[model samples]
Target: MGRRRSAVLTVLIALVAIYSLVPLAWLVVNATKTQEGLLSSFGLWFDDGRFALFDNVRQTLTYDDGVFVRWLGNTLLYVVAGAGGATLLATLGGYGLAKFDFPGKRAVFAVVIGAVAVPGTALAVPTFLMFSRMGLTNTPWSVIIPSLVSPFGLYLMWTFSQQAVPDEMLEAARIDGAGEFHTFFRVSAPLLGPGIVTVLLFTVVATWNNYFLPLIMLKDPQWYPLTIGLNSWNDQAQTVGGQAVFNLVITGSLLTILPLLAAFLLLQRYWQSGLAAGSVKE
Candidate 1:
C-alpha cells in the first residue's frame, strides 16, 4: 500500500514539474527565433535554419540606445534598496516584538496580523492618493517606503525568534554588561540567521518582481524597472512606428530571470545551513 501511494505521489510531482517547465521551455525556444520566425514556426522547438539566439540577445540589449541596460540598473537599485530595507525593518521589528515586553503588545500583534489579511492591491489607490498629496508619487521613495513594511516577514521572525532565541542567553549578555542594542546586535541577531535569510529571500523576490507599485509610482521610462520595461517592449511590438521586437522581449525575459535564478541557487546552501543550525543550539 505504501509503495502504491509513493508511486502515485511521484507521478503527481512529475506532472506538476512538467506543467511548470513547459512555459519556461517555450520561452527559451521562442527566444531563439526571429520575430518573423516566432509568428511562423512551432513554439516548443527551433525550426530548421532559424536559430537566432545571438541576434535576439544583441537586439534585446542594444535596442533603443541600450535602454534595457538602464532598466536593469534601475531594477537592481530598487531591489537592493527596497528588499534590504524590508528585511532590516522586519528583522528589527520582529525581534523587538518577540523579545521585548511593552504595553499593548498583544494589541500590536493583533493589528499587525490583521494587516497581513489586507490585500496589497486593495490599498493601491489610497496609497497612491497619499503619495500624490505628498508629492512623492513619481519618486523612488514612493516604491521604497511602501516596500519596507512586511507583515508576514514580521510574523515569521516573531515566531522563529521565540524558538531560536532563548531568554537565558539574553540574560547572560546583560550580565556581561552588554547594552540592549549591543546584545541584540551581537547575540540575538546571530542566532536568528536562518530567519533573517528567509525574510531576505522573500523580500528580495517580492521587490524584484514588484510591478504594480512601481508602475503606479513611476512616470518616466528612465526610472522603469525590468518588469515595466519588458512589458513596454511587448506593447511596442503592436504599435505603429515601433519595430517588431517580440523575439527581443523573449530573450530579455530570459535574461531577467537569470539573476533571480542565480540568487536562489547561490543562497540555497545558506538556507539549508541556517535551518539546520537553527534547529541545534549550544
Candidate 2:
C-alpha cells in the first residue's frame, strides 16, 4: 500500500511538471519559426527546413532601429532602482517593526495588511491621476516611486527579522556603544542575509515584470519597458500597415525569460535558504 501511494505521488509530480513545461517548450519551438512559419506550422515541434532562430533574434533586436535594446535597458533601470529601493525600505522598516515597540504599532500593521490586501491594479487609475497631477506622469519616477512601496516585502522582512535576529545580540551591541543604525548595519543585517536576498529577488521580479503601472502611466515609447514594448510589437502585428513582427515577438518573449531564469538559478540556493530560515524560527 505504501509503494502504491509512492507511485501515485511520483506520477502526480511528473504530470504537474509536464503540464508546466509544455507551454514553455512550445514557446521555444515556435520561437525558431518566422512570422509566416509561426502561423503555418505546428506549435509544439519545429517543422522541417523552417529554422530561423538566429534571423528571428536578429530582427527582434534590430527592429524599430533597436528599440528592443532600449526597452531592455529601461527594464534593467527600473528593476535595479525600484527593486533596490523596495528592498532597502522593506529591510529597514521590517527590522524596526520586529525589534522595536512604538506608538500605534498595531495600527501600522493594520495599514500594512490593508495595503497588502489591495490589488495594485485596482489602485492604478487613481495612482495615475495623482501622479499626473503631481507632474510625474510619463516619467520613470512615475513607475519607480510606486514600485518602491512593497507591503508584502515589508511583512516578509518583519517576520524574517523576528526569527533571524535576536534581541540579546541587539542589547549586546548597545552595550558595546553601537548605535541603532550601526547595530542594524553591522550585526542584524548580516544575520538577515537570506531574508534580504529573498526580498531582493521578489522585488526584482516584481519590478521587472511590472506592466500595468508603466502601461497606464507613460505614453512615450522611449520610456516603455520590455513588457509594454513587446506588447506593442504584438499589437502592430495585428494592425494594418504595421510591421509583421509576430516571430520577433515570440523570440523577444523567449529572450525576456532568460534573465529571470538565470536570476532564479543563480540565487536558488539563497532563495531556498531564506525560505527555510523564515519557515523555521531561530
Question: Each model's TM-score, in the order given?
Answer: 0.95, 0.93
RMSD of every candidate to native, in Å, equals: 1.5, 2.3
The 0-to-1 C-alpha lDDT of every candidate, in the order given, reads: 0.89, 0.91
lDDT per residue as tens, model 2, 159-244: 99998898998999999999998998898987898888888889999998999999999899999999999999889888885647
Give the C-alpha miss distance for residue 211 in model 1, angstroms: 1.4
Q: Which ten residues in a row have the lowest lDDT in candidate 2?
A: 273-282
lDDT tens readout by residue for model 1, 1-282: 999999999999999999999999999888888877887888997866667999888998999999999999988888888889989989999999999999999999999999889988778788999999999988788888888888889999999889889999999999999999999989998888888888989988998898888888899998899999999988987788555877788899999999998988877788888778767756
Model 2: lDDT to the true structure: 0.91
Model 1 residue 209 distance off true place after TM-score fit, in angstroms: 1.1
